[model samples]
Target chain A: MAYSNAYAPSAPELPESFVEQQLDGENRYHYAYQYQPTQQFSSSSVMFPPETHPDIVKSFESADRDRSGFLDESELRQALSFSGYEGISDRTIRFLMFIYKNPGDSLRLGPKEYVELWNCLAQWRSIFDRYDRDRSGKMNSTALRDAFFHLDYMLPTSVLQLMISQFDDGTGKNVELCFDSFLECGMIVKGLTEKFKEKDPGYTSYATLSYDVFMSMIIPFIVSYD
Target chain B: MAYSNAYAPSAPELPESFVEQQLDGENRYHYAYQYQPTQQFSSSSVMFPPETHPDIVKSFESADRDRSGFLDESELRQALSFSGYEGISDRTIRFLMFIYKNPGDSLRLGPKEYVELWNCLAQWRSIFDRYDRDRSGKMNSTALRDAFFHLDYMLPTSVLQLMISQFDDGTGKNVELCFDSFLECGMIVKGLTEKFKEKDPGYTSYATLSYDVFMSMIIPFIVSYD
Candidate 1:
């Protein structure tokens, strides 16, 4: 395959399995990460859902605190909060802004950009909601583990504890996860997972690579914003 | 668990499964990455194989081309080449040197540091040998992906292609992986896989974490050298 400045190829058409609906939730989760090609960034490729849902528009308006017809980082955070997400750090908000912001415009998200952001957030929220089970506004460690497992990452438990300790808002003994934190974890794991799969043109959901190939080549891009 | 500057608490005692003899090669591969805890970095914590293999000493001496009683980056590359490994880029060699070299002394590897680097490289070599079934000196793409799969990463094929293309000796169509490149890829994937499992306290092969928890706290370290 030709290497281009484009970080990823165009978002692939939804695969047969996705359209066929044969996949269970777990399989669908894996399929989404494993099969959905990493999206390339270009103004033309900024795919908004065919039509913005009314709820999304209303939520976006609510977040437009100044009603400037745009959503800045703060407004994006507010919108996420209004939609029942909390604990989103400024860094993460900025990252989404960087990813979705229109070409040559970094100040704020116009309505089209806002809808794109809103839809993606909603998708992620639904993922979080599925595992929150009790809807307690926070997820315990088990819920968190299952959430990732559903995404097909069967990571070890100690790593999870260390990960949780990094953000567990409760007193020392209690471990809980809120939506924003979950979103952050999902993004990194999912993004890396997709990058790992880029070699599998065969779509066998697997690839073979050596350590040197990853470090000198893949990791820089993983760390790079540009 | 208490958060400490310590990367990993003293390497947990090798698990009983490792001590038991029933594990097949694949199972052993799984055990090393999936069950083996991520190693921490402390000078005192550096664990060498109980005894130095004679081959390591011989190779180190050869790489000490000038017989200065130390191995610099160029020497390290030659030594690795002598051990049926070649095509290691200078940058990768330097990174390993920086990783394993003693803090105050960056010039070269003395005998002690040489043994440590030798042991780690030897372990990585054995891993490559398992996949290079033909002893052809280069691994094809399938071998590369299976190597990671054995280490518990189910990365997709395209990612593997992107990874391989970076180091593929082939002009445009052929994909070949020599040992040095494999070692680098294995190290990063293994390291990241272990980090992913760090959250799993139970050793149940799974953990749950939120994106915010991971991004705000863990990602910087993932991308950072120190």
Candidate 2:
């Protein structure tokens, strides 16, 4: 089973001191440590690039400094506080609790768990940015409407206002939407507006149209008349 | 079967005589000729109530001049080109011809058609007004982005830009979107970007999540690496 340089590329057991070369472009796994979402100027428009969540990986990687993947309370607390969470915000670590779903007290997530966290957090962040069209650190009625249109195809102006109202939490009775309450909702499509608001003939309903395919013929499927 | 009116409710029929009755409030057949969409706005929101077209049948009554269900070319042209179409120059009309599927056809629309037209044109108007968030009628990049975010997601920014770029046409590119374009294209989605740009990985491609449901989740689908 002896091998030469051509057959093995390098000594099979030379890892003790051999230096590895990094590839050009995205091939570098290091990229997993520096990803960021592209800029978005408006909710009506989307500016996205691929491969987000590098920062999350960097943090998680740091928490798992020993490369053992799983993090104990100390590592978890450090990661949590670094991520902008208070020491004990929800009274329970949902992420850790989630890992315990398989039963037993084995709630620790290792490297694989860390990767999954990055993926989820990364996408959630992106969704938040998408809704915040102005990316001025806030989203407004127009941005949310644009998002709703892309989402369903049914947002009567009133229903839209209601969705905005839910997040308004302002002193003014006439509350329009902005980025103010975004963080409150966790950035995921947790409780998006229903398909339509049921109303009579005079009742208004608008379907939120987001994506498209095939021909450009406008397809206004009343996802729900209600 | 003959039906009798309890209180001689003004018949859905229009009086052929020149009647100056106030038409009373809550008149089913003619509530000041108000359309829900048009009525919801404040004086500041819209440019002006779309001039009731000559053939618009403000009441169940026919047009005093045209006597048609939908206004004829002359009547609609007058309505569309009124002070509403104010600065629109002839050169602007020429450009609109290329952008719209059937631009040169006689300028006329029925009630249903007018609704479709307003839905699209009104959105563009909002963009213009949004740039003037303070309603100052001027804009900067911040204003532009905010206006853009406020724009419908299905609206194509490039197409909008093309329309504005041609503004120097002297005639003013005030070609309001008519019914045909809407039934044919503009109605396809909310904003133009949705028509083009590739899906960002930031999003879950909500197309995948509820591929069978609707597009509303697309915004939350974008993953924020930032």
Candidate 3:
């Protein structure tokens, strides 16, 4: 597949050779390598585009033991595990529900939403694998920056540093982010930016918010997640 | 003043000598050392306990330059600096307004709320100082834990570790928290615990929450502050 640079016009410029290297067949193979599992999953059981996948639908129905047409937290937990994401944290699950649920919906996930969430997770997993350059199941600061750049988020250096320190695994001297932390960090940046954009509709990067407005807008983001 | 152990029944037991050591005149002197400024501020212009302090009231009136009887963000920023807390972050100031303002009040602070806020800052400053064992203006993980213990919050070790890593200054190998980070860390733990307590009124350390309740409660804390 051809890499598209059209969406990332604001992305910081890099050396021409570096751009070419990233687009070369080897790197394309890397993307393909990480995406192979999803392909296999599609070919073996159901079609691609998880929204229509029979396995996902079956998993959700089976996990919804109460047959309420919605999966509660515990049920969602089981459903996600069945979809190969085991031991997902309660905080992450809550975050997922917050982002994907339809308006007027409770915290639970209906089948359609669950399938969409499964697709989202698959995308995040693919991103994680592509950035885990050493195959250590973690991304160092440089890899993290590159991954976000690939995703079209030109985060400031200070913000990137904050994310690194906030999500450091405490293993040792080196800072690294596992898959879950990467997801959380990315979602937080995306969510906060969206909130800020609401106040700065002109994309001016400046917003004047009354304290109450600021608190009301930010408090939910701060309090609800891990 | 005599040290009180009466409020911290759940605090981890220490050697009798260690307890005595902490209560000795030297440690008491350390507390007094940090408290000296507030004492001087009280004696020179107004009394302590802050609420009735003439100086605090005057500061508030001066900060309310518009004579609106409330201090907006910029005015509150100046007022905090006047009270010796220089360069307070906008996030911290908003958090203070969230905690101190009356139910119907807007983001700005009235005279009564300003005075109360000053008192609260003094208390937090004292806590930060007491735990900054080497007078380094920062607290390490151990000091951070001990400070919470002294405050009657027996946070689990895992939670303490999370606080340390989350608030690390990134200066070097050591994880140290400066005063502002300390204040944020303590407030987050206290705020989250209070929210959790509402659902676990029996103090059972367990609560059953629907996904909606969990997200609504936790998101505010996650989103609003730094």
| Top-scoring candidate (DockQ) | 3
Quality of candidate 1 docking, DockQ: 0.03
lDDT of 2 by residue, A124-146 (tens): 44655787765675666676656
lDDT of model 1 at position B5: 22
Stretches of model 3 off by over 4 angstroms after superposition: A1-226, B1-51, B169-172, B223-226
Worst 10 residues of 3 chain B by lDDT: B24-33
Whole-model Cα lDDT per candidate? 0.52, 0.32, 0.56
Please provide TM-scores, in order, for all candidate models, with all chains considered together: 0.38, 0.25, 0.43
Output the worst ten-in-a-row residue range by lDDT, candidate 1 chain B: B20-29
Instruction: Give the Cα-based TM-score of candidate 2 against the true structure.
Output: 0.25
| Residues A65-131 of candidate 1: C-alpha lDDT, one tens digit per residue | 7867678778888887887666676656765664455433434676666666666676778878899
Candidate 2 chain B, poorest ten consecutive residues by summed lDDT: B18-27
lDDT of 2 by residue, B159-205 (tens): 33322321212222343322222222222223222322223223322
Error of 1 at A160 (Å): 4.1
Residue A132 in model 2: shift from native, Å? Answer: 3.0
Pairwise lDDT winner, candidates 1 and 3: 3
How high is the TM-score of chain A in model 1?
0.58
Kindly provide the TM-score of model 1 when superposed on the true structure, using C-alpha atoms: 0.38
For model 1, residues B1-226, the per-residue Cα lDDT tens digits are: 1111234432222223222211111112133322222442223333223355657667777677676766777888898788756676664575466445443343366656666666667676777788899999788889988776665556555456545644532232566767767766665554444444455445443334332223222332232111
Candidate 1 vs candidate 3, TM-score winner = 3
Order of quality (TM-score): 3, 1, 2
